[model samples]
Target chain A: MKNWLSPRSTAGIVLIAAALVALPFVLATGGQAWVRIANFAILYVFLALGLNIVVGFAGLLDLGYIAFYAVGAYAWALLASPHFGIHWPVWAILPLGAGLACIAGVLLGSPTLKLRGDYLAIVTLGFGEIVRIFMNNLNAPVNITNGPQGITLIDPVSIAGFRFSGSSEILGVTLSGPQKYYFLLVALAILVIIVNLRLQHSRIGRAWQAIREDEIAAKAVGIDTRNLKLLAFAMGASFGGIAGGIFAAMQGFVSPESFSLIESIMILAMVVLGGMGHIPGVILGAVLLSILPEALRYGVAPVQKLLFGQILVDPESLRMLIFGLALVLVMRFKPAGLWPSPERKRELQPEKAGG
Target chain B: MAETLLAATAVAKHFGGVKALRDVSLTIRSGEVYGLIGPNGAGKTTFFNCLTGLYVPDGGGFEFAGAPLVADAPQQAAARGIARTFQNIRLFGNMTALENVMVGRHVRTRAGVIGAMLQTAATRAEEAAIRQKAIDLLHYVRIEDRADDLARNLSYGDQRRLEIARALATEPKLLCLDEPAAGMNATETEALRDLIDGIRRDGTTVLLIEHDVKLVMGLCDRVAVLDYGALVIEDVPAVVQKDPRVIEAYLGA
Candidate 1:
């Protein structure tokens, strides 16, 4: 049964495809709220996949990943919103946002490429906070981001005169805004998955993993480590940018508050909890974490009422406690993660064969 | 009479007040097993580092294959067909034996990000060729059966041989082996000697550093002795073995 759902199997592919196709319809019956949760989950999947490239493949911990996301969102918001009065199309603005975010990635990566581990993490954390604070305080200098008010009425995604902002009927199937965004996210997520898969098997991918394992050995074997590290950051940030642009267009709102240190940590947690360097594992981690809080928010109060005839603990606090416990337990028992990559699984083997 | 593959002239390096290598020079002829023997702190590894571009000499330079070696980085040195193994084994422990060798073939392969992403027919063919070459290298090192095994899982002698196989994958014209048989038993050491001979027999110049005096004397076509970071003598094995300075250097250290 487990093997049937394993990503390597044909049955698993079919099952996932069938489920993805049916999910929107299933949630549509219950209204847009569940679909919105799924949309956010998909967004987290995008963020996790992007973070996976840096933290997973390249073994570079980037705690400022949300900065790129923020850059991408701001780029989209400014270009396609009433705040700037530009109102560009989604296609035109998407690449620009991604490109700008990529530049930010390179800017951060180039200087910090020499730094590793906790030092790099601390620098990136600072970069993320700096970007947020800059965005927050930019209202006075040039009225760039409108200070803390954030951009509103951002333009929605439109493809070939078909706006995803409103309900649209396709083959007698009516799709709501959340449903439409869910499909788009799934499509983008699939594309990202393909990119991730291709990279994981490529020479560049091998070089990245080799750098992760041993940078000195990698350089000794002629891997141009400096450029490759930049590429990793750029590539990883590009995904974050795409996700950010989509997020801005979907919500029709952009804010510095949205891209916070917590967002970065959550994304990093998704990568770790899923299985660093494992694509499906990362996706699962993102999906699980994204849904877990919402599920707790809706389910915990009712469950508490039933168990004790009154609420003993607030859902928010309970939600965090459960999340923290889950993380700790997972780290303790399954250190490689829920779905570890083959190499990582070998690394975390119960008793490694005696040398 | 043979063409000189590597010629180091008056190479010098110093760490602060201490001279790690002072005026050390040697000429390695094409297709010869050259041995460099020295006691601890004799600067043999330092000279090896200088030749391999891991360390830039404070003064002087070396030429390889009739061109002045401009190896500011190890990659540049590798591009010039000079490959060396570490005194301690440095195989990528996480990777399989086959994958480790493929990394060594990285300089030889030229699939960029686009080609890799697109997985074009050319890239696919190249990747296959690389895998094939890597497998052949494993077979060459007599560890073909353990190709899929993690490098760290390999026995000590196998790991040493794997390092050699990896170095060979670079298709180097000059292979510098730093204490390749350091941790091996007598049988393993004998096997390693044969493998090193086989490597030189395959038309590659070999430069070796070893503490095993008998292995140095028996295997090296020519031997160079260093004392206090300076070359004491460069002669045939018999001549180097009997040198008073070499004897004194070994005993003193």
Candidate 2:
């Protein structure tokens, strides 16, 4: 039991969790703004982590990952809100969103299985645009998503008649804005970490890496390359779905603009910047991209006024510039990612030009 | 001990109008090194492709350890205790030597990615044991010191040796070498001979394809000469050397 917690990983989890948990308390003076940023960042970590499975571990570049995210958010909104008047709980919506996302993943990945490599990426990118446009255009006569304006005033989660909404205190804990969101995001991040770890270590993981390293070699060994790739795609998409569900609940709104192609690129950049197939790196990548912009939003203005005398940068522009430069620098230097999969790195080195 | 470690019976493969393999059949026994020797266009590599399930055979059957074979892919073959080195050393170049070997053990290792990431006791113990095994394998293939170096940095001989180690990482019962001595100096070839003998001594059944007749003859317990995808002769080195059919096929009658 004790040994399962390898000091390094255990310590890492402990440190990160402690830091995240303590951040809200430490930064409590400023209207709990950092917690909101943390929530946003953690949610993104989940998205990036999911994409890492599809893009990094499975070696399938998915530019349409945001579609699943949208699916999840919409699914959550429709279920939790008065849209249907069912008012499903967050726990219930989470799995439902994930299941829908998995199905969506299969739908997107199925026909493209035979395409291979960059072709799959382009197809997925098209799929993302398709999903967003579909959401935008789908609300004609019935008003399913409230059209381009999106479904608003979604209900907060209720568990066993215990509702977490409009500042409720449960078990002596004051649950308010970004608090439940942060908790939910943390839980999801942990779950993703665990699941991705399991997937990578299992027989399936080896098959994925084999395909990545050498498709011919993998086939020669009797691996079902097509099915395995599909499984990876679906599995990765499910995580995106879960994150989307939480996103809907946190904001109490759903909009087509939210899940754009830029969102997909941002997620991809997060995965790449952190390191492909490295869970910790993926997590880090997510938190950085998602939270960094939010932090810069409020902080950058004051810093600019203080340091430069004249305001030279806004939060959005500076954030974008920094992230873009970070991506460029990462690609220039650490192409394999921040923390690469050691075993994967090994399997390919023997024959690839340098190996 | 088990009749033969591997057996391909009347195997046939075709690419478009051209026939790559034409009803080729051969038996490979335990601890015995069977050499597949043939000239270009004789379908030597095609036979390998068929056997390993890279190119599924169009007709006929191949069996491993008395089990009927299917279009079993390479990773499946690796799982089923069959390992092979490629003709052109296909190592993961960006990875270090140790990592390359570790990947070979990937199928053999039961620990999942989580276990590796978390460094769980079960995973850690298993990983350590595997690391040791990889080290031993490197030592066996005579590339122990190069374990930390990137695979791309290895010399030709060391790269070949690393491939051997990677194959051994699968803990394979039957090891196939596709031109193990392909681009080697005589000394390296001699070293490979020792390595093959060592592997055989350690109880692995080896099936090798070689262009160098002398190396094939010197190393093989039995030689199966292929002429245009047909087994022209199967005998000991001396007997194969004396066979008129094999000579005629090679000498063009």
Candidate 3:
């Protein structure tokens, strides 16, 4: 049964997850604050893996992807939070959020898919802005989102009379705070990776890559390129939705600032930096990018404090510099990506490796 | 008489005021190489495009394998086992020789996006088998050693052969080759002739569009000569050599 997950990947993920679950307990002994960073990093991993399918495999650059995340967060926020006075189960909200995001995905992709490459990118960028502005200005006549004030006091998920409120203790362990979120996000990341890997080896996956590689050749071979692009858009958005729903429940709040254009760029960076078309690369990219800022935040603030007696380089400023440099250097040195696809690696070093 | 694998009956095509092909009609037979030969501005490529549904004919219908083969779209032509190579090589440049072939095998596999993402056991089994089949086609075309090479990196002769391999991976009942011997040396041309002969031996009917008169005359068993967007003659190679119209159109007699 375990063999089905992936030969070595299943074993690696299980061992890693088990180690991680035991780790925070060990790390909590020293700095409990590190657990929050860990949790959010895993969350980023899930988002990265999903976005990889669109930009990496399908070769469709999506700048408005964060809108799906917003949709998912809002879906959960409107449902579980007392702002609406409606408490839907987590199980129900997850699918509902994904489905809503998928619908939004199809709506966005159906028309814009005809536009290729850079034009498509610009359109999606506009879309992300449009969604954010729409959400921000929805307080025209009747107030819905409270006009940029945002929704708050979202309830935590509960399973079978077990409200995972910030106060529940189980088996001498709590299911709230950053620790539980870390474990849950890791599981979600693994799920996303498995799905991506499986898709890469499957026929539809090949078709998407084919369409990505050469639209004319793919069309000549009888693939309906339009429908395939739409599928990538919707499926990729569904992951963003799932991640957003999880974010809403974990934060116990929903705000416009959380889903921004920068968030979309950050996710794209993860897919490219990690190596497009490689699931492990995307996950690694997600973790590296998400954790880099915080780890540097801890390291840089101290150095700045020692030199100038004040914090000079903050995490936000450093992230932008590093992100820009990384894109340029990475694309130049390794155009395929850090962890390039097996197919790409073979093509790159035919005499040395492909045999 | 056979109804023919490909029949373009009273086919007419026009772009605005100019007529590209007027009332072009021809019947293509199975187990033989049918040549469409014409000088520049003679609409040979245009006629080939019409046959493959690249350009929808303004007038007339086509019949292939005793069923209606409408000149509506490329996908329709592909679905009916009509596979073609372009005049300019259009293989996925970044993709490996093997992947170029695998894309050709795509229509045969019916796995959907979700089924692919999940790898539903069936997709896995199908992937392995098809991958092997692509490798086999490369081997058959004498380029198995370069299966992992990027298509653009190949020598011109090998690129043409690789294109053929990719088209063959589609499992076409009838293969349409446009200028298969356009830029090849004597040795490569002979190898291509052997390869085309072998492809016919494997039971695939070939429709060849070539500019090389010697290669065309040597390879084709029965030639369908196209001149000025019309079928000039349909005869055995020797008979066509003796025909005045074939000589007048191409050799400038």
Candidate 4:
């Protein structure tokens, strides 16, 4: 506790909080697009943190994690959109989406409990594809999901009568839809971070790490490895669910294209690149990965034109090439990650530690 | 005579065509160091795994503390007051030495996901107690100074000791150690002997599997020798050591 509340850390916390609160306005000065990107970045933060629970903490490679996100988004779309002629409150729907995603998580996890490494990854990959396909095709039979056209006019998150979709002036400052969504996402991310921190330091966290280190050893020590693994899946999926719900409300839409395999892989890359099992590192990874592409999208074309008088490659293609190169270089140099957990750093580089 | 603590009846296990153990039985009384010794492929470790629920024996059952012990899983075996250390030193390598032991207390502690996430007062107290107890177990194994070190970074002998410390953290009625001194030097083996002696004196029955005949002959109150998955002999160490069948099994008659 004393270590946690040190003056330096307290000051750091206050500074970060101030920056987070001011970020939207700062981005809005540049352009509203930046704030939108920031909102997505926060959403990615939720996905990365949630995946970290499964892949980082429990050592379970989950490649179909975005399925839970799909589940949550569809839950919101079905409950609050005109497609179903049903409208549920944000609070009511978010929990339901999270609950449904958790059940989906358990369903996906139970069959793959006996697998490890590549096998588990393959199974999860299949699960993610299955969910996306279900969403894509479910429309044909019952007019559900709108068949890739997506459900529109979804209700924005509202409390009492104040809608997030509309601008509101508070304390001489006006908050736009994206800005309001940004605050909501940040608040939720903070809550998720707190939950991750608590779980990391508690018995459940220790058990997960133990299982990650050696499942047989963990079982020998009296840990119910099967149940704990399922718990990891459920917990991680619920976070993804919550993020998906918020994403649906923010976008006012839902589509199968939005929950693709690439998205799951990208979220996984964020967890791995930022630092698996480390909260700050994961958040950093999420923000960087989510924002970097947009930054490249906007910056690449102009910079190419200025330097070479013409673009050598399309900005979109160039952005991806640079992104791939950066990932490769980071992996080659860092091996563990950009901000690896101390234990993982030591585990991956035993020779340097003289162990 | 002390009360019987564990009894194995006609335990049998086979893998395809290879018969690992066949109809081997043994009894261990409370408060004694029991040793199991045999030649290579004699099924000593197999028997240990079967008892500890790492493997399900095709035939046989165990009576622990006068109850039918059906441990289909390792956690069930642990919850039934049986704890064990692996022959290959399977400590949670990335975790701190103390944390490795705290994990052993998982069966004893009652905090679930909600309790942990909430950090209820009782959960906090239990967590603290678990930590203190783990530290104590490390001290008992003389690795208290290495409590904060990652289990993987410790010296080989210290890692073995840490495994012992972790097993002891379960507060088991019976503790089993498989080849604990496998890679130890002479001095380390002597220290391990003292640690096992200390554990037995602390009122936990010990079941040890060892290849070190001298150590087994010296430390065990009673020893059992297995030859080709059959019981060669079971008696006081002095008697078993002199038995011709045991000699034949070891030197090949």
Candidate 5:
């Protein structure tokens, strides 16, 4: 406790806070595109934290987590978009979307309760694809989801007539649309992080970790493993739902393409790469994985042009290749993760010696 | 004589063609350290598992604390005030010694996800009480110094003690120890005998399943011996030891 409040640590915290506050302004100089990427990165942080509750804490391997995100996005699209000719407020839609996604989570979690490990992963993977396919085909019978073309003209998030899409002057500094959304995303992310931290130390958290360690022992200790596992799924899905609501408002669109199998894998990669069961590591993983690909997308063409003096391999494919290589290298070297939790580090210590 | 705390009438179980337990009727009175002993494959563990809800008996049932006990799951058994430690020491390895015990308090604690996230005044107080109780249990097992250590890192004897502490956290009416001294050294086994005595003296009924005849004879007030999944004799320890059937089962025909 004393070391936590030391001058050096306090100074480091203040420095990080200042940097977070100034990040968008500095990126604004590079243009609003970078600010938009930052917003998406924060969105990814929400998804990663949500997934961590299942995969990291409870040790349930879910491969279809993005289905919940899609649920939230479509919920917003149907009720708050011009396509439906309805415009509900943010407060009403956010919770509704979250509730719907929670129900979906429970529906998916029930049958899979008896499944574990790779089998659970396979079931969740099928669930994710099922959602995507439903979103794609639901257009014909009900004209819902707008099919492959997607829904447009979705209303932006607003509080008391103050629109996030519209720029406003604050302290004589004009804030752009993306800048405004960035602050909103940061505030929501902080709230989510607080919830995660609280849950991590609570009795419920301990039960989840117990089940993860040994399910039979946990049950023997009187933990209702089935209900608790369902709670994990519902809670994690609600986070995805909230993030999905914000995402729909930010992008002003809803498309099945945005919530793909690849997106679920990418969000999962964030949780695993950031260090499973560690909050700070997960946030870091999400931010880096979200931003790094964009950075490569922008830098690869120019670097190729400079090095070869001619156009080389496609920049998009090269960006993915580099991303894949980075992931492989990280996993091969730091199997537990780059910033693993202390408990996880201890779990691996003996294995390291034996291997 | 004390009232009956646990009564098993004609409890029978079988696996495939092998009969694991056959009409094993037993009565355990309150506030007594009862011992269940048998040779290998004599259905000691099978009967223990049936009583704890790990396995469903083929016939008959159990009455615990004057109520018919029908537990289909281990959690159900625990909720009915029956706590147990495993033969293989199944502690939550990644959790701290204190946390392992706190998990035992799960059925007693009522904090849900919302209360945990909100950290309401009542929830915070309950959490503190739980932590303090877990710490006290660790102290009871004489491992207060290792309260924060991971369960997996504890010594062999400490792991067994930790499992006992974890079971005690459930505040059970009947504590079932499945081969508690299985892998312990002589000194550790002696300490365990004293702990079991203390637990029974404190008014919690103990049901011990052990292979160590000496420990069982010394600690148990009444003993039941099983041979070929059938009860040979159940009486006071001295009387059971003098029984010819018990000698034949353990020695030879």
Candidate 6:
């Protein structure tokens, strides 16, 4: 136990945990805006880390990942919200949402198992669009998704009679809804990190890496690549589902617009920009990409007003331009990503010595 | 006579109009070094692919240890105790030499996702055992010092031997080596012959596809000659060398 928790790592863990635990209180003066942004950043970390399993570990390109997110959110909303009239407990529906998302993942993964690379990407992209369109049009036929108007009045998360959506005083400290959700999200994210780390060192993880390197060789060594790929898809989708459940409970709303193609691309970007297979790198990517836009949202307008004496480009537009430029620069300078795993670093080496 | 460990009967494969393998039948006795030799495009590699289930044979079936073989994928074949190397060397290039052999130990190891995630006692013990076995295999191949290096970084001879070490990690009853001495110097070829001898002595049947005539003639107890997707002759190396059909198949009668 002592060896596992070396002093330096123990110190680092304590420092990080304390900082995270104190963040909501520290941002109290800044209002809920900062806390909400942090919430979203952590949410994206869930998304990017989940996607790393498929794209980074399994080496499957899935552009329809947002479809799973939508499935999860809707699963939570339809079960716990006013639209469905079910009012299931948040805990009960969360796992169901994740399971539904896993099924969706497997369904999407099966047909595309034979497709490689870009073809797989296109199919997943279509699957994502199809889900979004289904959500948009389902109201007329069955009112299943409540269509474009979206599902509203989703129930807040409650565990053992303690409501997370409503404010409560803990040790004389009043916690707001977002702050409470923030703690829960942090716990969930930590769980994800642990799971991801364990998986990366496992036999399945090694087989996935071998498949990524050479499918034929992986098969030769007796790895069931087809089932493993589906497992990757399902596992990754489950995390997306959990995040979506949290998103629905916190926001009390779900809509087709929230699960758009751009959201999927943004999640993929987070995975690629951070460092594809590395867990820490993916979290870093997710946090940076999530918060950077908000930072740009506030900084760009003022900078533009000061530099140009007029609004040359809106902050949103500037954010896109800078984001594109950053991706390009990163690709050119550090294709392995900001914090590439040693394996990924070797894989992306410009010129391998052996040819 | 030793029991026939592997008996492939009239195996056939074709690609559109081109027959890659046709009517190829051979039996490998337990604990014997069996050689499959042929010219370019003689379907030696294709035959290996069929046995390993990379390609489904159009006809014929196999019996291993008197049990009808039903494996239809490489993984299944490996699981059933038949491991193979590639003619072009298909080592997982990015993985370390030890890791490559560890992957070869996949069929023998049984730590699934849950066990791996929890790092249970069984999983840990299995993984440690696999690592030790891989290291031992590397040592057997005389490349234990290069075990930590990436497979692609190893020298050509070491890489070829590494492939053998990897195949041996499956604890296979029968090891199929595709041109194990390919691109090796005469000295390296001699070393590979000794290695095959050692493998057979260790109770594994050795089935090899080699283009090196001298190495095959020197090392094989019995050799099978393939020409134009068909087996022309199978006999002792001395008898095979003198056969008119073998001579004609090699020199084009």
TM-score of chain B of 1: 0.98
Instruction: For residue A84, give model 2's deviation from the true position in Å.
Output: 1.2
Winner on DockQ between 4 and 5 is 4
Put down candidate 4 lDDT per residue, A59-169, tens digits, no spaces: 999999999999999999899988889999988999999999999999999999999999999999999999999998887767877877888999889988888987899
Question: What is chain B's TM-score across the candidates, in the order shown?
Answer: 0.98, 0.95, 0.96, 0.98, 0.98, 0.96
Q: Using lDDT as the measure, name the better of candidate 3 and candidate 4.
A: 4
DockQ of each: 0.64, 0.25, 0.48, 0.68, 0.60, 0.67
A-chain TM-score, model 5: 0.96
The predicted structure with the larger TM-score, 5 or 6, is 6
The weakest ten consecutive residues by lDDT in model 5 chain A span: A346-355
Query: If both were scored by lDDT, which would come out higher, candidate 1 or candidate 6?
Result: 1
- Output the better candidate (2/3) by DockQ: 3
What digit string (tens of lDDT, one per residue) describes model 2 on residues B1-253?
Answer: 5478788889988889888788888889988998999888888888887777677898887888879766746667777877888999887665568767777777776774446556667876776787788888888887888888877778988989998888888888888899989889899999999999999999998989999888999989998988877788887889998888888887355
Q: Provide the lDDT at A82 for model 5.
A: 83
Q: Rate residue A224 of model 6 by lDDT.
A: 84
For every candidate, what is the interface RMSD in angstroms?
1.7, 5.3, 4.6, 2.1, 3.3, 1.8
Ranking by DockQ: 4, 6, 1, 5, 3, 2
Tens-place lDDT per residue, model 1, B224-252, is: 99878999999999898788888888835
Q: Which has the better TM-score: candidate 2, or candidate 6?
A: 6
Report the CAPRI category for model 1.
medium
Which lDDT value does model 3 have at A250?
Answer: 85
> For residues A1-355, could you state the per-residue lDDT of candidate 6 as single tens digits?
2455898988998999999999988886798888889999999999898999999888899999999989989999999977968999876899999999999999999999888899999999999999999999999867899999999999889888899876799999999888998999999898888888888877788888888878898888888889999999999999989989989888899999999999999999999999998998999999999999999998888888899888888888888899999999998998988998887787666434443
Model 5 agreement with the true structure over A238-262: per-residue lDDT tens digits: 9899998999999998899998999
Which residue segments of model 6 deviate by more than 4 Å? A1-4, A350-355, B251-253
Model 3, which residues run further than 4 Å from truth? A1-15, A26-32, A164-167, A312-315, A345-355, B12-19, B70-72, B228-231, B242-245
Given candidate 1, what's the lDDT at residue B135? 96
What does candidate 4's lDDT look like per residue over B1-253, in tens digits? Answer: 9999999999999999889999999999999999999998999999988998889999998989999787568898899899999988898988989999999899999888788778789999999999999988988888899888888888889989999888888889999999999978899999999999989999999999999988898899999999899888899998997788888888456
- Off-target runs (Cα >4 Å) in candidate 1 are A1-8, A350-354, B251-253
The digit string of per-residue lDDT tens for model 2 on A186-255 reads 7778878777876675455656876777776555444567777888888888988988888887788899
